[model samples]
Target: MKKFFSISFVLLLALSGILAGCGSDEAGGEAGKKIKIVAAHNQTSPDNPYQTGLLEFKEVAESKSNGDIEVEVHAGTIGTEESELVEKLKLGAADVVLVSPGFMTQTGIKEIDLLAMPYLFDNYEHWEKTVDGEVGEEMAKLINEKSNNDFKLIGYWSAGVRHYYGKKPLEKMEDMKGLTFRTQTSGVVADYWKKVGAIPTSIAWGELYQALQQNVVDSSENSYPYFVQQNHHKTDNGKYITETAHDYTTRFLLVNGKKFDSYSKEQQDIIIEAAEASVKAEREAVYAQEDEYKEKAIDDGAKVNEIDREPFIKLAEPLQEKAAKDMGAEDLLEKIRNLK
Candidate 1:
């Protein structure tokens, strides 16, 4: 598997070079020429919030610009992996894409990972307050400047709130002890789960169904819409869900900054306006899906239980502080904490 992944990375690198060379040498030139922005996301599901958001962007931009701007949206057709999509964005093969902060951190700007830290927000409101506020602005600046303006964060979206689903319900923190839980294998997520006595196991998103079915991992965590959409609730090991709500997942709608810089001032304003619409549409879709999917999970014979998440939140504070300090975002973390 390691060897396969290594080869995939090499091929993607080669593809990035080819894509960079294939595009017009001048990206943001000649405003009158019909400009096509290739927007992509790795999610194949048409109902996904990412697709909804990207389609909103396409519709608003094309209509408002009167076809001066053509937005071609691809759902998992261009690249089925976010890493590849990010590479395409930098190379100008893809003009815009969605990604989590964890992937952003891999670009060598550690501060972006601050948003991915679990339990940082008390709820969706607190999460929004931080990301839609000065912290979000500062992080956007950091991402653009650090990537040499390769990435411009246009908007923030959510994957709803994440909770735990497993073969058994976690009634208390001690219930996680000795169970192998599939989650992020490194960073603050793993640290928090590990401190709770659950072993953190890394599994590819695509392979998680089989992993859970075969008991390769005893438990896993994700938002209601995501796991239920995948039919994970039907699996033997995925039937019991605990509302940990440990994370209010954040995703970034990012465009190629250098390419965006090349656009006419009017074009830039329209694109930003479209992004605002996309953000609103995406959040509404996700919030609605959370309740819809949770009900569907119950109707499908999957059990749901609520936990007193206060203890979990307490456990996360020190972890959040450590993560922020490590990433040099102590003040930003404090700001997020106070927003609650």
Candidate 2:
């Protein structure tokens, strides 16, 4: 009887060890589960600054996660429109996205339109000060709250300073009259353009090259790197570039806030760090490419000219002030101007 009892006791100990091994494996698997992130931007060009910025994000995120995180970046693959990206982001289809203020405003976040106002920023210095300071923090908090945690602003990115490029150069304020300009169709930007006498027309970014080639639009405005890289200068309606310096454009690097909240504290810290790195890399790329592409445009026979921007700035200021008040952003507007 004693011998039988000893054998049963040994079996019981072995069973307990087996169960403990299974528990350890289950916990290990849960802790080491691989996470996948889908990062996307609207620009398709591999040489574009958007690509540069996102690539930096991917590198930083993956490296910091030690192979537990995988980032799949889609540059106009999943969607070419900012609206589409924003929609996907809200639905949790996209993990991270890049979008401009105008498109973001269409998602019912009109307060963001303040960033899209023409002549709102005088230069890159003013822009950096506004977006990297307390004003930016307030805007970010507003976005998070307004979005109900659907969107979280990771960083502010620049599309560089926008200038006017079209079939004809604007020598003066009157030169814009009657021009069918391809630009934002709504918000303060379109209002400012119309007030300056250019009839604003909506054109998709990918379609603008064809529109310019076919004379569907008489004029368009953008930064040098954007239009020049698309070979817009080669189009019949895109040869003349006037340095209006109208908008120092702002883009938002956003993550799905709910998904972000679901991540471990370590993962969230890594993502924020990655976003900071991306912001720096992207701005540097845009600054460098602006000079590079401007030279390229000139060398490629695009006529470049400078106009008296004071008139445009004068036309834009009242609109900016009124729009700021309408959106309850009067203080934010004052803050922006003070930064200048």
Candidate 3:
């Protein structure tokens, strides 16, 4: 009887130890569970390229991880302006954000602003070559260094080229004279518009339609897709399209340095792969839709004109020279110009 009791006690002790070990393992596994990421953008819907790319990222990240990671999109919910978005990204309030190169000027990478200079590229191919080549890599490196390890640029997505639209047909730069044109608050953009003899007026994108309806502004410039998507053509306040192609706007997919560092090496690789895939998909989509949007604008009563691009290009020469001398972007501009 004594032996039986001793043996039973020993067995109970072993069983308890096994159960305790299992509990610890379960707890550790739970603690090590999936990583969650939030991607923020100014896009309000999935229809836009920025939002679509982010959605693709979410799908690829989650699907590829087999449920080990999750990405939530905070489109147009975090902030309305680019500056605000950058601030949120730096403060770590946002894990990821889609920002324009224009905003990088504040970080001492003023050279990026020169990319927005009017009529910089002769065609989309030239634009792509410059961005995908050494110049783009250098700019990215400069941005990373200037950011002080707060943000990492994952990829660049197209915002397309901006063209002018107005109520009256503008056949030449002189036709833009005295027109109250809606302009971004960018000093370079404002100066460009001023030099072209138009009155540059600053208006938030959300308020543009109302501003147009009330005759607050007579004209604006943007990519054809944006103009079409925003229903600016329907306003009937403007019907002329100029082939100015002033800016080849681009947005960056940036990640929080701290949040990215927390992920395992395998997880980081997966996220970057997903981001690159989404960027390729987005570029294809934008190029496919570019002409479609232009046709749609014409069908909707907007008069499309293929003006002499050379004159506008010549007009922009002074601005480029001024930017080179005063803005310290001459080297970057020269690099882009030298690209074959």
Q: What's the TM for model 3?
A: 0.85
For every candidate, C-alpha RMSD to the true structure in Å:
8.8, 14.7, 15.3
Q: Model 3, range 38-68, lDDT digits (tens) per residue?
A: 7888756456777778888889888888888
Model 2: C-alpha RMSD to truth? Answer: 14.7
Q: lDDT values of the candidates?
A: 0.82, 0.84, 0.72
The clash numbers for all candidates, in the given order, read: 0, 0, 0
Clash pairs (backbone) in predicted model 3:
none
Q: How many backbone clashes does candidate 1 have?
A: 0
Ranking by lDDT: 2, 1, 3
Per residue, candidate 1 scores C-alpha lDDT tens digits across 47-84 of 88888989999999999899999999999898776788
- Candidate 1 regions off by >4 Å? 1-28
lDDT of 2 by residue, 1-340 (tens): 0000111222233223322333342332244456789999988889899999999999999998897778999989989889999999999999999999999888778888999999998788888877777777777877877887789888888898999888988899899999999999988889999999999998888898999999999989988888898999988799999999999999999998777766655566577778888888888899999999999999999999998999898888999999999999999999889987
**Of 2 and 3, which scores higher on TM-score?**
2
Candidate 3 segments whose C-alpha is farther than 4 A from its true place? 1-33
Best by lDDT: 2
| Clash tally for model 3 | 0
Assess every candidate by TM-score: 0.89, 0.90, 0.85
Clashing pairs in 1: none
